[model samples]
Target: MRSVGKQLDITIHRPEELSVPLRRAWHEAMDESPDYANPFLAPEFAAGIGRHRGGAQVAVLYEGREPVGFFPYERNSFGVGRAIGLGLSDCQALVHRPGVVWDMQELLRACGLSVLEFDHLVDEQKPFGRFVTGTFASPVVDLKDGAGAYADWLRSTYPGVAKTTLKKERRLGRDVGDVRFVFDERDPRMLHRLMEWKSAQYRRTGRMDRFSRPWIVDLVDHFFQVREEHFTGVLSVLYAGDRPVAAHFGPRSRTVFAAWFTTYDPELRYYSPGLMMHLHMAHAAGGHGVRLMDFGRGDKEYKDWLKTRELRVGEGFATRPHPVAAAHRLWRRPVRGLRNTVLAHPALREPADRLLKSVGTLRTSGRTGLERPAPRTR
Candidate 1:
């Protein structure tokens, strides 16, 4: 038995190997902690990642007969570990009961990891706070009665936005066909289209195209097939007549709808379809009982306009005393520091953005034969 301090028993298992009672306990922990409400923190998401990632593991912390916490991570052969689905997952958390804290060194030892790396860690994780190297603002929209309620809030929050958006919607319908918004589209074809748009968007922005990887593609498809109440793959589309102008695919817990993969047709950029889709999505999601829409962590003008508030998230490496841990932190910290510096300074960021666009133009010309700037999917 792997026993940690505070009389906790730690058991490591593949996520799929978790017993029904343990999964239920995991769900209960999520319900008990507001910070763990993100779908990324759920056992279902860990299980999904485990299906695709061979290294995926979950450590269940038990106090006698009761399970009290769940830690999901991916461990490599060198004893290095990372929060499961690190790059793609917008939220990273150790779901646990209130007041239940673990010793970092003991936890890492129990899991057979020298270091645990994470980004987008929820702020309320007090045990991990000391390890945090940086913190960022994660914007979110508070939902209420329905779309109409949000529209009013948006109008008041961003003066003249409602009028401008309405005018654009009218023009779009007139130019195209009757505009339509689907909150939970089930069509496989539409999902494929969204991935295509997202891939092109990444290429056009000089960003790594995640969909280009087979495993990433398969993971997305797997998520699309998931239909649990605690975790559902939601595909929202904004259609101009029979043609889809913009689409978004993301997971939602019962109350939180995370804004994930979103992309729009390049030709429809003039209508600002990306922004339009977001507005409509908020309305529909609110009507569907969603109380919060998390925009993830990013510094975008649209997030500033659309958000009701911001949640703080952290990035860091939680390490035990080990040579491997030291080496891993040394190699990774500088890279993260430089990138954060570039992103934090506008003078540096603008020039970098322009350079990316210029490179994007050349790449798009040589690759996709489609070359034009479109609004980003926030």
Candidate 2:
């Protein structure tokens, strides 16, 4: 614990230990800024991560004994820390009141973190902006008024894509069955099915399977049961009559929806069920009071087609002068650079994506051993 100039107090505690008053204060602070309004910044998300990850902690900042800010992170034994739910969370920031300010170095010292890394930090964080290595455009959907207006705007903006999508939706309904969408599904079975589909998609894309990890699996399970005013695990599913075709699971606050895990059955890929699912979600979410849908940091054609605007997010490491920090940065910077370069250019990106797909195919084939089965010793 440390006091900043006798006017502010910083205390670190386990995420679950945050009192209701503190949580309420945190919510109030979030409402003060659009940057912090993301559900990923909510205390409920921190508490959910804390349940599965032992190192999760929150540093609460108090001004005159009233909670004004909250910083959630996970620190390892080596004093290396990261934003809470770092890999999964798309928006990162210290949720603070409008007039509250704190010294970054002192805050890090008080929390006992020698180095902290963040990839999706909000742009308004000037306190940590000096340490940023790079910035990326995180696309988002700006829903004006409600779903119907946005759909009309979409049709007016991209008539071809909008017309084609709607035509496909009708065809899908006619062929598969009556297509129905449930915005806030409570069935746990659908959640498991989403995870399974996501895991397969990860394998098929040569990406790390988050669902394979026990901690992440448990974290999702815990968050699924969390139903609160500020944070709720929203499960939106697109069903063909009775069969689920596409589904999405993410956290939602009063105004912001973080697009997290979404997957569709491969059989329905031709129908673009994933896109339809998002369209329906955006419509339903707008009716439910959500204003912004964060599509997260990535470059995809679909994201480009759907996004009305973009937000800037930073990626960098804030560290005390240490040999470990230097080494970590040296090793990590180039890999990120290479990936970003590939993603930024279509010529390079197309080849890189194909290579990754080939590698994924080989990896999946090797694991199955179907290509080289042993023969009987007759």
Candidate 3:
């Protein structure tokens, strides 16, 4: 690590050596941004994952003697690193000073990373310049003023869908027996239920079961149990006849609810319970002074229908300080090019999804005790 002049000191810390002061500085700097409120960027969450994942490196950017920013990432293989627990996280990147000047190439070299792939990176981090893989549009509902204003906006923008969702909610209340919605439900059992549903959904869709990982499951459980002023795990459940038909588990800040993981009973898919739950969540969040509902990354039909605005997240790779880094980049170029080409074509998207599914199936079948579970009916 190198220092710039006499103003800043740059250094890397092992996962165990991450300081509290550094974390505080990171939070303070990142919390200043309005459109940025991802709990994964917080120290506690990163530290927790780092403890489980191991080989995590914390890069502290200091101004004089005071810590100004922190970048927490994991060294996965051959000095390759990525945003900590990236696949499982809805938000990516570090809690850094917004306009801080830093060389991306230099930082990556310091951290000893090669091919830093990020799925949900902030749009403003233009370190990659023209090398951005592609942009992902995440849907969001503005709850800044209140839910009432959001509802008004939704009525004006997506009147038909909004009206249908509201009617479905009412119908659920009348027909489903005591329908209720809870935001920030502090129940570990409820979170477990949500995971179970999510796992089942993954298997049904021939996708990878994220919760199958012991560390990820434990991480989610730990977060669910943790309650704080700014960072807390929220489980929003839509109950019908005392049964949770739809559930969303995510992180929440004082004024933002980042929609992370969500799943609903397929039997109740006709009622569009997930969308109804989101509507309820929006109203409830507005009531609780939440200013935004971030739907996270993904191009889903529901997200398109529900969200009022979209935020873009970029992707790129960073190389480590090694001679092999160049060779690795050359090797990965074809793969990245193919991915970009497929993503560019609308018709190829479905085929790409199928190819991924086939690969997942092959991997699952080849592995022991990782077989996809048979569909369960509720």
lDDT (0 to 1) per candidate: 0.87, 0.85, 0.73
Cα lDDT tens digits for candidate 3, 263-336: 99888898898887777777787788788888877667778777889888876666545666677667766786
Give RMSD (Å) of candidate 3 vs. truth.
4.1
What TM-score does model 1 achieve against the real structure? Answer: 0.94
Candidate number with greatest TM-score: 1
As a TM-score, model 3 comes out at: 0.85
- TM-scores of the candidates in the order shown: 0.94, 0.93, 0.85
Better of 2 and 3 by TM-score: 2
Deviation of model 1 at 19, angstroms: 1.7
- Against the true structure, candidate 2 has what lDDT? 0.85
What lDDT, from 0 to 1, does candidate 3 have? 0.73
Task: Please state the error at residue 338 of candidate 1 in Å.
Answer: 0.8
Residues 1-378 of candidate 2: C-alpha lDDT, one tens digit per residue: 588655789999899888888988998999888989899999999998898888999999988778888999999987888989898999999999998878888888888887888999999988897889899999999765454664575486557688888788788888888888899999988988898888777777777777777777778888888888789999999998898999999999989998999999999899999888888888788789999999999998789888989999999888877777777778777988898889889999998888777766876677643232121110
What lDDT does candidate 1 reach at residue 63? Answer: 89
